[model samples]
Target: MTDFITRFAPSPTGPLHLGHAYSAMLCHDMARTAQGRFLLRMEDTDLQRSKPEWDALIREDLTWLGLHWDAPVLRQSEQISSYDLYLDQLAEHDLLYPCSCSRADIRAALSAPQEGHPHEVYPGTCKARPISDRNQGDALRLHLDRALVMLADDLPSFQETGGTHKGTHQIDPDQAQEQIGDVVLTRKGERMIAYFLASAIDDATQGITHVIRGEDLFDFTAIQVILLTLLNLSVPTYHHHRLIRDENGKRLAKRDDARAISTYRNDGRTPSDIRRMVGL
Candidate 1:
């Protein structure tokens, strides 16, 4: 009764802080308690920001917290070809196209006045735009032709709420069409494969049974779920945990160096102190 699988995937962009410690400890402990397989993966896809030193430190820090993984650590940077193949496959399904919309273009488009609408939705200016139209400054996007179909037709998907998921859901397809509307599935210039693609592919390739991460990313899960279906990859259950916040009730990040593990270590804080500090 224990075929659970979990992964602690940490980006190697910065030193692990209290927030990271909390996520790591929580994920690893839950996996262990279920007698499941726990794995480690370095999300060092951002070549510009990811440092090998930081990756090494995360491994050391998690180990210091008495957590272990079942296999050699997998790194996202090593799986580019795998991602590329999936993008091409989706295009073969006629589900992807090229787009030239920049961030400013998108934000500005959404800001424009529209039929008494209070807020902006991704108006899909490029939805009907032909792909042959020069991809000048544009990036490749996964067309949501089936996004509405999958959701309306009762797409087989599940959400993990801190543990194993249950039952298939008939997602509202309009949400994807409105919120996503063929968002960029692959960009030509970005070193990091967009988060949605990288995560969906990694989870499938790694046999990850559950994806437990911060809830702030819950909105983005729909995109990943959509991608999983597009790529013919298995959708892992998702469990978005509560984030650890600072005294100001703001989310913790590397920007908060004062809460860095190194800073705590320098002040002679022990492993047990970490669990307490982060309220684990």
Candidate 2:
């Protein structure tokens, strides 16, 4: 049997709030229950916002919460070359194209009201651009239509153990083409990769069997699964747990310093108190 390996990946852009505490503690408890490995990863691909001090503070807060992760923590910043290799493979398949469209440009092109659409789907302005035409500051977007056709024989799907949309769910080609058209895999300047791409590659490379995260990210799981299938990597089971919200019923953000774990610790809150607060 494969070991139940899970990970708690957090961006070092801000302080660890109650929301982060809930996710980390949940992952830690589950790993311990299964007697499996719980790994820590720093999702610091956004180099502009990611800071060394915040990274140190994150480790400190996790330790203070009595949540220990298996060592040596993985940092996405160190895996740029690895991510590039995967991008290269996707490029070779002719499934990626350079996109130089800015937000204003996209909005201008999409002037027609896209009512009932939850997200602003890219209009694929650069879909016809060849890979050879990629510039230094251009972003790379996936040709979802072409990729789906490539996987026409066997579409990508995943198993969800938790969340509102639990059970087996398959990626519908029609819905994907409409809702998730030509999603960006690499940001402009090509210095950073998209979260979907990086996380998908990391989960596969680390051999994570179970992905435990917040329910808010559940919607984006399909794109990750698609990328995994395209890369011929193993897809892990997903468990999207409920988020820890503030008293106002709003989801806690990094700016919510009052609900930060560090604040609670400084106010003399115990780990057990935290577990109770998060309904663990």
Candidate 3:
């Protein structure tokens, strides 16, 4: 069997919470079971919000949860040049286009309701515009329709090991247009890299074999697969596990500090207790 490599990447915008613990422990156990490797990554591309204290606390929380990684943590902020390189590759293929549309601009352009969210789909207003006309302050977006045509001869498929959706699947064109529209690869503000572009590139660079993440991200896997295929990177198996939610049946967010791992640690909860809480 090929070597198994997995990662638990978290943005250090806030303290690690129960949801973070659940995802981390799942990846850690999966790697251990395969006798392979597990990695930790600080997805701190959002420079404005990410904090040094949160980074240190995240490490402490992972250690407290009895989880271990095989490599020194990979920080996304340190790898800006790598993302630029991939962007250049896309540009060479004519798969990327500059977009100056802000959130308000996109919302106003959408004439119909989108599948998940209207804002999720880009109206493609700037797609036909010349690349030379794009300003330095504009964001970059993937020309999804053209990208699919570029890979029409050999689109990719991925294995999903997560319980909700198991087995291999292919990207469908109809769903791609409705659900996975032209996604922004770079932001206009201080944070230049988007989650899809950054995480997809990091997974390939880190040699992540199994993308063990939450089911909430299950719908977005197709975009990453497409990005990896376009960049000529190996696509990894995906295992999007169930999310850990609160008593109200709401998935926990970083804002839910009451459910933060640090709060539980301070409350005298043990590592074993966390495992039981998340149903390991």
- The numbered model that scores best in lDDT is 2
Q: Give the TM-scores of the predictions, in the order they appear.
A: 0.86, 0.93, 0.93
Clash totals, every prediction: 3, 0, 0
C-alpha local distance difference test of each model: 0.72, 0.85, 0.83
Q: What's the ranking of the predictions by TM-score, best on top?
A: 2, 3, 1
- In model 1, what is the error at residue 113, expressed in angstroms? 26
18-104: candidate 2 lDDT, tens digit per residue: 889999999999999999999999998878788999999999999998988876899999987788889988999999998888844
What TM value does model 1 have?
0.86
Question: What does candidate 2 score in Cα RMSD to the true structure?
Answer: 4.0
Model 1 clash pairs are 99-138, 100-138, 160-238
- Can you give the lDDT of residue 213 in candidate 1? 80
Question: Ten-residue segment with the worst summed lDDT in candidate 1?
Answer: 110-119
Q: What lDDT tens digits, residue by residue, belong to model 3 across residues 1-280?
A: 5399999999898998888899999899989999989999998876767899999999999998888888899998888767888888988888777788775553232211222343457777888875566676677788898899988998788999888699999998778889878887875544458776789889999899999988877887898899999999989999988888889888788899998999989999999998899998
- For model 1, the stretches where C-alpha displacement exceeds 4 angstroms are 103-121, 129-137, 150-152, 163-169
Instruction: Rank the models by lDDT, top first.
Output: 2, 3, 1
Candidate 1 vs candidate 3, TM-score winner:
3
Give the distance in Å from residue 134's predicted Cα in candidate 2 to where it truly belongs.
1.1
